[model samples]
Target: MGLFSFLKKKSDPADAELVVLDTRLRAGEPSRLDSEAERERQRAIARATAAKIDEIELAMASDIFDDEPAWGSAARHPAAAAPAAPQAVPAEELPDAAALPASAPAVEESAILYANGQAAAAESLLRDSLQDFGRHERLPWWMLFDLYQATGQEAAFESIAIDYASHFETSPPAWQPLLPGPGTPQSAGVAATESLCPVLDESIAPRLARLLASNAPLVRIELGAVRSADAAGCAQLLQALQTLRKEGRELVLAGADTLMTTLRPMLAVGDRASGEAPWLLLLELLLLSNREKDFEESAMDYCVTFEVSPPSFEAPKRVSTAAPATGSGDRFLLPALATGDCAALLDAIDAYAAGRDLLVLDCSRLARMDYACATALQGRLRVHTEQGRRVELRELNHLAAALLRLLGYGQETGKLRDSLRLYPHRY
Candidate 1:
């Protein structure tokens, strides 16, 4: 598994090794570089690698157990053995081995890798196992799809997507475009939901709204731990939201879980529902392509419809330079980041995260907001709507907000935003 690290560098060693590369030592004699002996050596290496893999595969194929055995007799033997690390997989992480509920055979045990916070390692594991798993057992297709997209492996993702679609007609989206806008479009070319609710920070409500609006076929609504200010009836809202999302839709999510709702209050953010502001300059790149006269002017109609300025980033800032202001009355700047400085905002977040007693960022002014920002942030981050729409800190400038957006955090104002923060419940 760690072998890929060895292959990353492309043939760059040292000057002493350079002369060794040019000469072929056959039977302790220096010969031409492209000699038969060199070709024979390479073929031998390939055969050894392949033979080694086959031997390991055969050994693994012999066992069908709930837990992998630590030491095998085959492993200790010297004559017929190839060095093989025992394939260790979490028993609980896999599906019930007693009953797969799946039509596939039990010849090779299929493993489901559930590494939250272990994203990088998971990707590497899946990639290396892909070719072998196709014939023996299905790798966690959903995860593979995610890993492919996160690491920018489009071709690999597409191949996996096709295989998955052929196996299960209505699977989730490929990992790319994980944080699409509330009104983003889907590609008909691939077999996937044009959208997904990642449940980490992606606001499912906004994604649901987009799916409902655009009429995308496949949808995944995660109802793990959604909550609202009305503590007693939070479950009902979670159920209702799912039902509402499912209505007039092609699929339904049916289940129960041990998840409990711990609701938070909706914190206020900035007033860039219009997606304006100078620091989010990359966003300006999109506006540069905007041909419609009403694109920016009318854009607020969607997100601004409930905007809240938030405060926070983690960088440090120097307030000597003034930041560009959004339309004035509706904007607030968090004290730490309000200078319209990303460096300062990140610094403040870093400080706060490290136990510094400080308001890392805040909205300096009072501003009106709509539901769109909260809902949009929730959808983008894939957090439960009730969970996603809250702002942890406040007062966002366009740049700070944009950085958050690019990184999948958001400021939520208005009712939806209100649903996020921790608050006292009403009767």
Candidate 2:
């Protein structure tokens, strides 16, 4: 039978939600751009993206069990058809397919194991498939990778994903968020207790959505049992918190310290190359929980301690030979940005003009910044504006100026001193 026909005959309720979301997004009128524009824009993009995903999924479903394993056809496809260049692996990277134990579970059985929350059993099943049959089936390896991610086994996920890509010469399927399950709604201010295992992939979002759907004023997420987390978990946690904040509700992370501490190192590993120190998830938590002091302090410590910061614009440092670069009044000198400097830099700015009416920041020798820095800088500017302070950012670099402009800082308006444009065309 054709893919669509098969889907019609074999109905799965789990797939229904995706179809509903897609349909609603496609049919709904676009919201007001100025206020609801960004959200609506995102929905439109998601609907379009899902349409493409649907096409791929339909194709996969149609030929799930073709005459030969579907993988062989994919491997023989032209290189241009692939999304990324496949990594080359040594011969010993994967166990030989033919050398499998007779008792290895079948792929169909493994899916049942996964659905039953038997992650370990499911993992073993897929690994046995790889060992017994190798890349004859691409689906098994993708399933194994998902298991690894869900279990918070970053190293294992990386190794298997690399090997799988090398063997198949194709990128692995992306980890999807958790789907919304039937959840019993509770009253406002009721704390929800969710039993969690190691993995925090896409599933957490859907789960949290159901809990938050109660529209509770305070949603206390009891994470007393969760020991570890992955990037997906952290991201979803942030998303959950942000969603709550938007609704004027509070998401309290009960017993979050231990899990967050365990997650800190993993996040650091991911940030090594980027040099954007301090996990945004952690920072957002501190900010929303009203621990601004702790957030600022941590941000400074992370920035100052890191060796390499992400790339940003730099303004040459001017020696105070003729006059102090900042005006004679109480002013602060913006420091050169090294790796992880954004948090501390903002702290320094705050410290310099704590109680002053006029705050002057000398950006003479500013260097190296990324989007994180830009965002923090914009935040600080907004804070100053709220406080009714006269602030000036002197000798700003071209890149910094451009970033501020893109962030909605206006040069034409002299009233909003939150952003200042000095040296109209500085290189």
Best by TM-score: 2
Q: After TM-score superposition, what is the CA distance of residue 61 in candidate 1 from its true location, in Å?
A: 28
**lDDT for predicted candidate 2 compared with the true structure:** 0.48
Native-referenced Cα lDDT, model 1? 0.32
lDDT of 2 by residue, 1-427 (tens): 2334454522444345446556777889442333566557666775775566667765675366332231122333335442423647422122112222334345556644554456688678778779656546554665565456445576777788678767765554332211111221111122233434446556677667766676434344545455666666777777776666566553334445445565566544324442332265666555543455666765654555564342221221111100112123323545434224466667766765677786655443333234556666777766776677766665443334333444554332555633333321110
Candidate 2's clash total is 12
lDDT of 1 by residue, 116-222 (tens): 23445555665565555534433344335544543457787777777754543334342322222223222111011222221323244454444455433433223
**Residue 16 local lDDT, model 2:** 53
